[model samples]
Target: MTYWSGFCSLQKEVQPIELTKRQEMILQIVKDEGPITGEQIAEKLNLTRATLRPDLAILTMSGFLDARPRVGYFYAGKSGNQLLGEHVRKLSVKDYKSVPVVVKEETSVYDAICTMFLEDVGTLFVVKEGGILIGVVSRKDLLKSSMGNQDLQTIPVGVIMTRMPNIVRCTLEDSLSEAAAKLIRYQVDALPVVKEAENGGGLEVVGRITKTTITRAFVELGEEATV
Candidate 1:
């Protein structure tokens, strides 16, 4: 079956290509004398047309060179960073978000710590009955609460969690770049992904965006270039 793909598929099709020695020479030759045929380029390089075919194909496919019917190859004139930015901007938060680990506000700080360790997550979203977000608790928040003599089991997470209107969050529609910027600006490890609730209630937690998620996206981008 045929599956429809979005602009994100371009990430795989056009990567920040690393040109080889011969490929570099071919590109320079095209830049100097464009609208030149493959046969002509091969002649300039002192190689046969058959020998230069692979280099020519790589350049054309990577968007470094453009070819026309009988007109020959010309430079596409884009820098490496320009191409990288184009692919990265196409990624949306919805494509990379992970499932959220959440707890109710009434839960004790002790239980929250156990949940954080069990799930291997650094931040936990505190929600009401319908999964409506009310606050956010971090590893640091739990640690600070544990330091005091107050009974961890008795104190509710609501007492120490950073309540809403102050929590950093993103929505499914946000770009991955925007989410990354928030993480840096706030100096937080993760941002809860939220959306409007059906009954016009507060934002409801849907997913999460983290440093690891953005890192994985970039790593995939590099890997695709090699392939």
Candidate 2:
């Protein structure tokens, strides 16, 4: 994509990137040379291409340079901070929440464990017949239950899960920062993303936020910045 094309876009955003002096110099070199090859840039600066390859890679990946196969790299004229600020300040939970893993409130503890492992999730949201949020169960919750000889296959997860009116959750409107705090403040790894039920009933589980979700968001943001 062109450099100006990214100006109006957040590029999904990223944290401010700090550039070393040499990296800045390399960017300046590319700016002056215009659509120059990495070998030419390095040779012009009296350095081997191998010596400067990492800086070139960093510049291209962080939005300062654009590279094309066999065409070398060109200055993209984008700032790392400018690209990153948009995502952190403007993006909300709705963009990052993952599909929620849910099971019926009446589901057996054994079944919930199987579902958790099958879905590869850290936490499971227990819902009513209509997918209304009712409770939450984590790996720890299952482990505690499993440690005992209580009938896991017959015992309901609703009995061991953290019941509603107490579950830590976020709405679609909540910011990513707020979701991160909910994870930290509650000392939990995940939060059920919820929305208010019809009229004045209760929350309906919509999605989920987890450490993995945040990590994946940053990974994608970095990828977008590069593109």
Q: Per-residue lDDT for 145-179 in model 1, tens only?
A: 99958899999999999998999999999999999
Error of 2 at 164 (Å): 1.5
CA RMSD (A), model 1: 16.5
Highest lDDT against the true fold, candidate: 1
How far out, in Å, is residue 216 in model 1?
A: 0.8
Between which residue pairs do clashes occur in model 1?
none
How far residue 191's Cα lies from its native spot in candidate 1, in Å, is 0.4
Candidate 2: segments with Cα more than 4 A from true spot: 1-83
| Clash totals for all candidate models | 0, 1
* Candidate 1, lDDT over the whole model: 0.89
Error of 1 at 204 (Å): 1.1
Residue 124 lDDT in candidate 1:
95
Write one digit per residue (lDDT tens) for candidate 2, span 1-227.
Answer: 67777764655465579899999888887776655678889888899999998998888888889875544577676444633553454458998888999998789999999999899998999998667988999999999999867889998998899997999999899988789878999899999998888865788899999999878877876675566
**What CA RMSD would you report for each candidate?**
16.5, 15.6
How accurate locally is residue 170 in candidate 1, as Cα lDDT from 0 to 100?
98
